[model samples]
Target chain A: MQHFLRKTVAVFESLGDRSLDSFERLGRSTLFLVRVFKSIPFVFLRPWLLIQQLYSVGVLTIVIVLVAGTFVGMVLGLQGYNILVRFNSESSLGTMVGLTLVRELGPVVTALLFAGRAGSALTAELGLMKTTEQFSALEMMAVDPFKRVIAPRFLAGFLSMPMLAAIFSAVGIYGGYYVGVYLLGVDDGAYWAQMQKSVDFHEDFMNGVWKTVVFGFVATWIALFEGYDSVPTSEGIGRATTQSVVNASLAVLGLNFILTALMLETS
Target chain B: MTRQILEIWVGVFVAAGIAALFMLAMKVSNLSTVSTGDTYEITARFDNIGGLSIRSPVKASGVLVGRVSNIKYDKDYSVAVVTMSIQNRFDSFSIDSRASIYTAGLLGEQYIELVPGIEDNYLEDGSDVVMADSALILENLIGRFISEIISK
Candidate 1:
């Protein structure tokens, strides 16, 4: 009885410590996010740095986005075609695929991929710079590392995410077409006709654009915050990279659910 | 040299995204489907307009002819008034044509389907389609089934 009581007390104590640690981290992250936003003017001042970061973060990730997008779209086409066929409404496969991709899967998938690829890379790069005392060196030279190093990368990530997501969606629609029209023998005209009749520009497509913009902001903010706050060690760099991806993904999904509910309720 | 290339690539990327968005608007969204060509409006009255709304397609023999332009409740007749815009090309529908609300599939959207009669004269603009059939309400059918079972 004494041992059990002691174990229970220890568990509660650890839980309390974890909650307090999380709250502190949250406060620090919010401050870091604000500081990053404040440094946006610096990004514009040195447009070269923003361009360099955009190339590294956005351009480098294109191949993966294209490949993942094509596969996702093909799978959706196959599955949607089969299900719609069951109801003798296979002609609406285009509408089903288009709506599903634009409304939900497109933004969500792009955000997750960006988190895993660009977010982790950002965390590692910053964490390594911190571990090597490079930030301190910059401070010695009277350079604000936040303005010079972090701002451009954060802005690039924010800008690139929406564009990458749009490209993914476009490629995905073509993949769906390849499967549904070329392979499954669904009527080409009916597919496109149904899509036009059903999908609304403001309701579906622009809503997706809105979602990606929000996701880009949240994911990049998390990535930058994790890296800036990383403990100055090799292990800390590794941990920060992993945590950056995981946290960004969770934030994207949670924010998606909330945004979806709000968008639906209002519209 | 690399800076110029990267700048060009970024411009191309932005342009591609915009192009895709424009294609989506043209191909999938209803934005481009609004008929700006010549069309005439007509009204129909029904007792129940179940699952019907503006922008629903107006079809004749499985061919889309126009769209429902507006819907209103008539206080004097205690009926639903539905206005449809028919294209000029499909102006051959007769004055005695019957308009019935129908579902595309078992659980699909409702549309107004017109069946032409043997009348010599064609329907004019601002004319009423007097033989309007109301929509089939599924709930009412299920309730009737349950009541019949209880009585039996």
Candidate 2:
């Protein structure tokens, strides 16, 4: 019993040490990122990273955004019309649709969609690389894997989410317009004019963009961290992929709350 | 690689063009003014404006002809002074044109519906329309309904 207790204590101590080491590495990595940012001109000069990011954030996820935007818009319009007709106040359809799309739906839905697409792909790619000892080979050759492997994805995710968010917002508003004017037979002039008047472009647009950037960072960081720290087996790769998606999704939601609070307080 | 790059560029252009067209359609549908020959202004006083905001459509017989330009409080009268810009083509709006604050749909928006009067004399600019209906406040209506139910 004494020997077992000692063994358990030793295991706990090793875990504590490993956690401390992880924290230390995280601090060093953050500092490294700061240094990299200082040399951002050189970083931006590399077209490969930019193209990768654009592809990840914009081109690859086009179908998801298109489908999500259309459906959400349709539902919002249909529901809004039902509620408005109850009070015979159908003219406010534009305001309802515009506000819903800009403030909430645009950022949240786009990020969720991105998490499902690029988030999963990123995790799988990184996990496979870690499992195959590719990362070990890079380290053996004295290549900084973080810079070569992780940084491009990090930068891409950071850039891509906001661009995707902008597309989502624009398309969503149009979808709402389509349902409101054509299907509902609401006066088109009234709908557009009210939307234009109520929605302040800066507040909605900038807030949406800012939220997406934070979402991007959280999604990329969690996925990469899971992939990098994965156990050395096939089962470990599977576990890491699952954990990556779960953690990234949770982080996205938590960060969204924090950002919304900050924006409200500052505004 | 070059072909792939060209394809991406084409995709980007097409996406941008589609977005621009949608924006253009929305703008043209809402902002363009109809030339109604003679311009007239009518003032309607209401206790509450509700969702009667600026540039909200003013419809007559389900046809949009003008818009509510402004809403201001009449300090002495304690009423909302709503100014509507009507096109000149509907020139026969006499003293009896009934203006009602009505909503487009349930959970939709509020607009003023103008019922043209039979009197031949046209309303001059800045003239007050005598027949005006106050906007229905949703909360008040609900409260009144609940109270009635309780009383019964």
Candidate 3:
């Protein structure tokens, strides 16, 4: 009976502790976010720092976005064509591909890719700097690490996502067009005309823009916060890197559903 | 890599992204535009629009010439009023040009087809298309055909 009572109390205690731990992390991250925002202006003052980080974060990520976008679009075209052919509505291939990319897949997929590629890299880099005491080294010279090291990377990651999403969507549209019109013998003029007739700028495209911006913000925040708060050990750095990717992906998918729901209501 | 090389790469990346956005605005959604600044407005009334909505294409001789800008029910007249904003270059349409609601294909989008009528003057902004033919309802057509056959 005493053993059973101890097990019950331990389970309750474990659950309570984990929840409290997450709450505390949330509060700390909010403070970290505020500090990052405060240092943003300082980051802009030195454009070179931001540019260099942009090279690492944004430029390097483009190739993947483009290649993935093309394949995704081609797949969509093939599937849409096959399904639409059954209904004798193959002319609508353009509308289906264009709307699907602009409304959902473009933003969501690019974000997931960004989380895997840039988010993990950011976390690992910051975690290593912490492990090597680079943060303290900067502080020893009376230089604020947040302004120099953290904020630029955070800004770069935040800025990169939307641009990447646009590139992805555009490339995907081309891929779909190629597959639908060239490979499948669908009429090219009818494809474009049908797409132009259906997809609305205000309703489909702008909503995607907002989704990417929000995703960018969440992805960078999770990445930077995980890195800055990491335990200063090699093993801890690895753990933090994993946590960054996982957290960012979950945050993105969850936020996507909410944003999509809200956008649907507005449109 | 060197900072200069990195800067160049970033510039190229940014340029590509901007280009992609331009393609999306121009070729994807077409930026929700009727494609010109100088436009003229003309309203037409139909008994039943039959799935016609705002932004539906307005065509003449199978060529897209304008877009439907607004649709409202005229309670007093018990009809649907459609406003079209046509590009100014096509201002040569006669004042008596009539519009018919047309379905493009089987289970396809509906649009407004303007049929030109010989007249002395051209249509200007804010003028009405005097004769607006309503859309054909498939169910009503089938019902009428069945009733006629049974009566006969």
Interface RMSD list for the candidates: 1.5, 5.5, 1.0
Worst ten-residue run, lDDT, model 2 chain B? Answer: B24-33
Candidate 3 displacement at residue A224 in angstroms: 1.4
Between candidates 2 and 3, which one is better according to lDDT? 3
Model 3 spans > 4 angstroms off: A1-24, A188-202, B31-33, B36-40, B75-77, B92-95, B118-128
Positional deviation of residue B73's Cα in model 1 after best superposition, in angstroms: 9.4
Ranking by DockQ: 3, 1, 2
* Native contact fraction per model: 0.62, 0.02, 0.75
* Candidate closer to the true structure by TM-score (higher is better), 1 or 3: 3
What TM-score, computed on C-alpha atoms, does each candidate reach? 0.81, 0.61, 0.85
C-alpha local distance difference test of each model:
0.89, 0.74, 0.92
Candidate 1 residues A1-267, lDDT tens each?
A: 999999999999999999999999999988888888898998888998998888878887878898999999999999999999998999999899889888888899999999999999999999999999999999999999989999999999999988888888888888998999999999999888888778878778889989999999999988888888999999999999999999999999999999999988766
Give per-residue CA lDDT, model 1, range B1-152, as digits (tens).
57799988777766876776777777767778665688899899999999998878899998888889899999999999999999988999899889999987889999999898988888878989989999999998899999999999
Query: Where in model 2 is the C-alpha error above 4 Å?
Result: A1-42, A140-142, B1-3, B6-152
Angstrom error of the Cα, residue B136, model 2: value is 16
DockQ of 3: 0.64
